[model samples]
Target: MSRPHRPGSGIRSAWWCEFSTRTPAFGDGDERVLLRAQSAETPTQVMVWIRLAVRVLLSGFDPRDTERAYHWLDHGQWEAVARLADGEPYAFTAAAGRTHVEWSARPVLFLPLAHTATGPLGRCAEPALCACTARGHRCGGHRR
Candidate 1:
């Protein structure tokens, strides 16, 4: 079930859409807590969180964000990220018959989630592509 709309709730919704890839991973209790926290956050705070999560994912240091993202992102969305990471050309250095992988730093790009018939909080069959344009409707994009 979708939550009731409140002032600034769109920001929270948009954050979920962008960060979670529109997959609702949270349980009812977790959703309540996260929504409350997100509702209290400013736009700048949300952006900072997104940046930190992306940085953590790219660095491959912490698995927490990755785990969360796996739960939050649908299969196609996760596969897209995996493909991007896998396609990255990394250098390998060999020393003493041992090979070490060195990953090159790549710029992370934030792409907006495509709108679906179920909206941001709903389950979509095709999570990677936008249905709004295909349905001949204009999407307002993300809410400010």
Candidate 2:
């Protein structure tokens, strides 16, 4: 079994994601914990975090030219959406979860789990992701 998730304490701070191509990499639980410390709730602290993120990501890009890029960790996976040399849309995602991450070129509708699906705790999935997108988490698939 996996270790229980404690809130904003211990090594796990709910869930954290970095937008870098390297450094922490994806699925590194310890790094996730470290990144969570960025929640300082101040403008300066937030700016520092953003600068760190930008420095890490820019380390991989060409300095002489501008390139469109976006990357972030989602549910412990590193997701990158960028344009190729030919300017074609490209996206890649990888995770340590049991259910394969599914994406489609065409728009896809995802259904949410019924309220009854969650027990009394209402933790059908990661309570955070549930409140936002329909993505499930850490449950070995089956939509949590």
Candidate 3:
């Protein structure tokens, strides 16, 4: 019913960052999951740090850990932007795929650095904050 946000900026494509999620694969009443990004391929030596914002309505992990996990992204270079309990098995593997942006479980209207083929998406006032809910209206943004 809802779609996840996608970013089309060169940050993930041109710069070569890959995004993926980790979730439990076995029986569980409770579990931890994580969504993160890494350099699948890049030419520059300067590390590209991702500012991940989790807007999930409900997560398997502790809700209190959400905001704190978001800030953890700033401190690490291609590390777990989100943390979840490892009690569950995960088959997730980070693959190099081109995208402009992405969301965890729901679609969101994320700001792009520039205008895309679809249309222009305004930049987020907070540099660290890129995800937003534009209701049901299309915001004309992509992650490729």
TM-score winner? 2
How far residue 36's Cα lies from its native spot in candidate 2, in Å, is: 11
Question: Residue-wise lDDT of candidate 1 within 38-135, one digit each (tens)?
Answer: 21023333334444444444435235544544444333234433433453322111111121212122223334455668665533322232323345
Tens-digit per-residue lDDT, 1-144, candidate 2 = 899876542232211222222234456632322222212222233334444454454445443311322333322111221212222322222332221121111111233444555443344343223222245544334354
Off by more than 4 A, model 3? 1-15, 27-49, 52-61, 73-144
**Local distance difference test, candidate 1:** 0.32
TM-score of 3: 0.22
Best by lDDT: 1
| Residue pair clashes in candidate 2 | none
What TM-score do all the candidates reach, one by one? 0.19, 0.24, 0.22
Candidates sorted on lDDT, descending: 1, 3, 2
- In each prediction, how many residue pairs overlap at the backbone (N, C-alpha, C within less than 3 A)? 0, 0, 18
Rank list by TM-score? 2, 3, 1
